[model samples]
Target: MPDQHSTLRAQRRAETQRLIQAHAVRLFTERGYDATTVTDVAEAAGVSPMTVYRHFPTKEDLVLIDRHGALVAERIAASPAERPLVGRIGGALIDSVAALTGGGHGDDLTADERFLLARLQLMISTPALRAKHLDNHYALQQAIVDALGDDATDPDAAFHVRAAASACLAALHTALVRWAEDDGRTELPELVTKALAAAFGERIVDTPR
Candidate 1:
């Protein structure tokens, strides 16, 4: 009974956080970023202003964090080390996309994809948001580095892994931006795979037997 209650409570908390984030985005879209207040979002979400603040400490975070970055980081960290480094990274990226889109691998953007695209658009349109996004890039890279582990201890392998990670990350960002600009006409997985191939040559697409 206690375990069930804890599970229910956790579920409710997640729901509340999602509710707050959704309302905040709506408010941001309807009103300008500067014009939207925490109180307004709280009212729309049917939660207290403090609750909104607790869920998202800053307005920028409300737009920047969809929790997908953490998901990708977790997936990469959990990925088996025996695979080729780029292959592992690429597979982890695809897994993250699948989880984010609720299991679709098609060209069309899911509802969640659209929501994230809106946030990306918002960030690109606002200078402050763009700066915040850049700041987050390092943290995201660090997460990848941590996931990749002692590859960094050896100078040669360290350089190679860092370069590979950077190329992969750049490929991902390019794919996302291209998808947004094209209005989701192209499949994200295809774009991602293509970008990685271009960046890493044929190795990214090679399958292990």
Candidate 2:
């Protein structure tokens, strides 16, 4: 009974956080990000300032909160261990994009994809957000490295894992940048696969321009 109650509480908390973030994005879009305040987002979410602060410690947190690292890590951990590390990481990245976009493109974007697109646009346009975005990428790289479970006792193996993680994430970042630049007309999963192939010396096929 206690465990069930805790689970329900967690679900409710997640719902509240989602509601607050939705309101924050809408308000940030309506009024420039710089022009909006935590108070404003709280009012838009119909929650108290305290509640907003409890969910998002900083204004940037509202825009920068991301679950990509967890998604990538889970996929990498679940991938066949016999596969090359770079291939596993790269495949995970492409898979993550497919999951996010529902394996579709253009008008078929899922609500999550649309939300991510908006966040990407804001991050690219805002200098502060852009800086934080790089930090987020670094964190993502670390997550991948951790997921691969490189032996800390072997410096060479650890270094190799870190390098592969960084390289794969760079490819993913390039794909995301191009996706944002193209206004999401191209299929994101395709772009990710192509980018990873080029980076990892795999044969590249033409992706929709």
Candidate 3:
């Protein structure tokens, strides 16, 4: 039932994505994200000059985390139909801590996660990654705007829904920065709830370090 050309195209795109990510992760681990060049990735991936550019326009795009957008879309899509957007978004936010930190590490990450967090902290502290992070946030906000518009029938109501969405994401960001300092010993989901509540009202009781 599937169209062969469409299926082939999907396969090609997935392969290209894998190649790009593979090379990018290497350069990121070696010379660091900021110092790594697109040319370096192309050479490492054994692709033509234009092919690399075709997949990722800028070097930052090579490592940008659009996974956040995917998660946001999935979160909203799975929510109850009749719940208010704010409540659903809030619940999704509070529920997403597991998805955020629950995989890949085999044992207590006290050491491994420290190195992993250091990698993330490296990205966060780098100007290039920070710029990419900002770009990612704006793109994510636009997606939230689109999702809000889809869910709200009243033209005037959508704006408020999106504003609440923005607040929720901003709360998540605030909590992540604080969590990063803890080096992943503590759970981020708990911090997310406190941060979301604080963003709305009341002093968020930060879990004791």
Candidate 4:
């Protein structure tokens, strides 16, 4: 019963955050990211400014909030332990990218993909957001390193794992930036696989057509 209640609370919190972020994105789109205020987003979301602040402490957070790290971690956990570390991490990243873009091609984007595209465009155009986006990249790198657990404990292993994680993430980032630049006209999963192949010398994983 307690577990169920805790799960319900978490679900409600996530829903509130999603609602607030949706309002923030709409206001940012309509009023320009620089012109929109948190209070305005709060009012539009029908929540107090405090609630918005609780979920997203910084204005940049409103645009940059994402579950990429969690997604990557989940994929890594599901990967076979016997696989090479770099391959596991690289494949996990490709799978996560496929999931993000819904493995579809061209301009037919889902609602979530459209929202993500809008966020990516804002991050690309806004200096502060771009800086924060790089910081988020580091955070994601750390998440991948953490996922390696005991495998990264040795000094050499740690260095290799960190380097590999950074490289794979760079590949994923390149793919995402290209997808946003092309206005979602290219299949994102294919771009991710291609980027990883260019960096790693072969496809990390087979992306479904």
In candidate 2, stretches whose alpha carbon ends up further than 4 angstroms from where it belongs are 150-153, 203-209
For every model shown, what is its TM-score relative to the native structure?
A: 0.83, 0.91, 0.73, 0.93
Per residue, candidate 2 scores C-alpha lDDT tens digits across 32-107 of: 8999999999998899999998988888989888778898888888887777778788888877777777655678
In order of listing, the candidates' clash counts read 1, 0, 0, 0
Off by over 4 Å in 3: 1-5, 94-97, 100-119, 153-155, 201-209
Q: Is 1 or 3 the stronger prediction by lDDT?
A: 1
As a whole number from 0 to 100, the lDDT of residue 168 in candidate 3 is: 79
RMSD of 2: 3.3
Write one digit per residue (lDDT tens) for candidate 4, span 1-209: 99999999999999999999988888887788999999999999999999999999999999998888988888887788788777888888877877776755566788788888888888887888998898899888888878878878889988998898988888888988998888888877788888988988774454322
What lDDT does the true structure give each of the candidates? 0.75, 0.81, 0.66, 0.85
Candidate 4 clashes between residue pairs 3 or more apart in a chain or in different chains: none
> By TM-score, how accurate is candidate 1?
0.83
* Best prediction by lDDT: 4
What local lDDT score does residue 38 receive in model 3, on the 0 to 100 scale?
Answer: 78
Clashes of 3: 0
Best by TM-score: 4
Task: Using TM-score, rank the candidates from best to worst.
Answer: 4, 2, 1, 3
